[model samples]
Target: RRTVRAIAVACMLTSATTAVGLASLVVSKTVMLRHFGLTSGLGVMVSYVVIITFVPAVLTWVTPPKREEVRRERTSMFTKVSNGLVARLLRWRWAVLVATDLFTVGAGYVASGITVDHALLDQFDETDPVYTTTLLIEEKLAGVRPLEVVLVSTEEDHFMDPEMVQTIQKIRNWAALRPEIIRTSSYGDMLRESYVLLSGDPSVRSENFKSAKQVKGLVTMMSQRDPSPLNDWLTQDGKKARVQFKLRDVGAQATMRFLDALEQEIESELGDDETVSVSFTGEAYTASRGQAAVVNDLLGSLLVAVVVIFLLLAFFFRSVRLGLLSIPPNLIPLVATMAYMVWREIPLNVSTVIIFSISLGLAVNGTIHVLARFREEMHTGIGREAALVRAARGTGRAIVISCVTLMAGFSVLLLSSFVPVRNFGELIAITIGGCLVATLLVLPPLLSVAGGDGGVRDSSD
Candidate 1:
């Protein structure tokens, strides 16, 4: 019965794992859900469900269970069962493995923090023809980070008045103080700062329009057209003036800070008055703030997942200690991923935030399986030592297999055309790998020290 039960459990788990893997492939292929509208959280949740539900159900009916072995004795059976596996795992040198992983995760944190963000354009290598062409085009053309600030007046005709024109010029001068502000241009700046030079005397400035006499001759000689063309940028009613500025190679965090400061400066210059006001509209600014909002959402979802997992563990084990203990190992991969991001110079964009949250649930899944098996063994009246061995022996292969299934599921994402999704997949792959290591190496040692050979219910206390 014991042998049959183990086989049944393993088969059930494998099938479920396979289904989830396949579901990930199908769901990931869908365009609107994967890329445009849904948040990464919603997408990952859907993908995870698709995998978990179908695979196990199909496999359970199809595959036969492993042959059952009758137990000759229950006392030393657990030890004998896990002996070979434990020895094999220990052969890898746990101390060295732990030390290396700790150092690597730590170093990644430091490196990621120190590295500057390379612009999106720079991400493609020079060897790529597209990158080369883009670089050449960028040099000859204007910048890519599009931003604009429109200053509007209560009355349209007021925008064309000299008072409004000077106000716009002063705002441009104030904005020039920020290094991130590359350049500012407006109709007002041209009229206020630029002027006609006398035909005979280059050194002299015209004191009056009449002194220049021939406005037509002056316009014709300068190879310039009437400033009236600038009206296209102004509001139809002539109540608003716009000053445009572009940023170079700025990440979401930097963009947010810049906007915050710019808002304050705009408010200081153009207060809550009835005559004038400033409003900003652009993809760059909106996306930056949106990315930050997504980060907060990811954090919230992870917190909820943690709580749910904790409650489930506590209720299932009837032990708060075990429940609390499970939470930290789950967090290991998250912290490590963050440290990796900090190291790799990857931005916490929309894609990565979703992967990071979903990864928490995934990393904990294997641990839950192992713990569940361990509890089952103990409940069956096996001794703590025997139960611990039974738990390890029974669940090790399933845990390893589950990790394989997850890796296979996430691999499809590597083929994504979207850069953000690709980055997300890579980070998730790392988290999955890290979790596997934690379960196989860290969990075993931790279980040993924590006395998984179940004594009293609360080990920590």
Candidate 2:
């Protein structure tokens, strides 16, 4: 029964953890979704996960319990590593390598905090014609973000008030100073521009044209090009008004900064007590702000998963030190990956934001397997250093196999047409690779010093 439980736990940790990372990759292929929409792209993702996760899991579950027999059948004297240069290093040289990895992981943590934004095709490519033309539109036309900010007030007369018109005009003036902002379009801007074009006509210059016929004629002229989705921005009762601004490009950090500033100004100007408040939607700039919220949610999900992992580890071992040792290795890979992005100038987009959340689970798998084996060896009365070697030799094959499978699965995303999704996959694969190398090489040595049998307590306990 104990043997079966161990096998089941091992299989679940390896398979399910890898599945989470692959799912992040699957959901993030933006080009597929962008080109085909949700129905087709989402269907492909669901099918892909099912095949990858279930097929291997079912095969592992049904396989006969003759791992020892298979091991004996496969081994020859050459497989023993009795006396080569490689064997000599395995015995004495791993300490230096482990120290270097630890240093890299530590330095990486410090570097990830300095955030940078991506350029228009930084998520795509300037070499691609579609992306190039898109860049041209952003650079030449100065309109990229497609966000609209609507100001709504409860009193019908409030929207037509001269004060309200002046407020929107001020906001537009404030927005125009930022480089990432293309332009701000409001009825007030239209009024002023049109009034100038109409040879300074007093009738056209009236801030609140209460006459329905005059307002209708003005609306018709503005609707000629309708650059800002003006119809949708209007309130149902005609008591609300909207201002629209397009970003210089999607995923621009400058645009996000500008929107946040504009939102704050609107809130401060109107105050919460008044019925006047600004609401936002309908542009890539809005979606970029949404990405910040998504990052917050992903962090929350990670915290929940960490709680679950601690409970599961405590339940399995009834020990604290082993569980505590497991935590650092799981976390470092994510920090390292983010650091790589910072160094390489990758922006935090929707797809890239979720990588660490998913990678956390995958990084834990090899640590679990390694720790499990080390504890088992200690129970059999092996010395700490000898036990480390036995643990590595025993579980190394399984850990390497799982890592390879995960790397291959994530590598499939390199074929994606979306540059951001493709970069995300490749970076995640690199992180998983680092984790695998950390577990098989660095961790075994660390545990020799750290995982003292029955001496270290679980941090949670």
TM-score of each: 0.68, 0.71
lDDT of 1 by residue, 317-415 (tens): 567766776665667777777778877767665456666546765667777776667667766777655665667776776677888888878878878
Model 2 lDDT per residue over 36-62, tens place = 323432554465567555666676778
Clashing pairs in 2: 144-247, 145-246, 145-247, 146-283, 320-457, 320-458, 321-457, 321-458
Model 1: pairs clashing at backbone N, Cα or C within 3 Å: 15-55, 15-56, 16-56, 19-55, 20-51, 112-342, 112-343, 156-238, 156-239
User: Of the candidates shown, which would achieve the greatest lDDT relative to the real structure?
Assistant: 2
RMSD after Cα superposition, model 2: 7.2
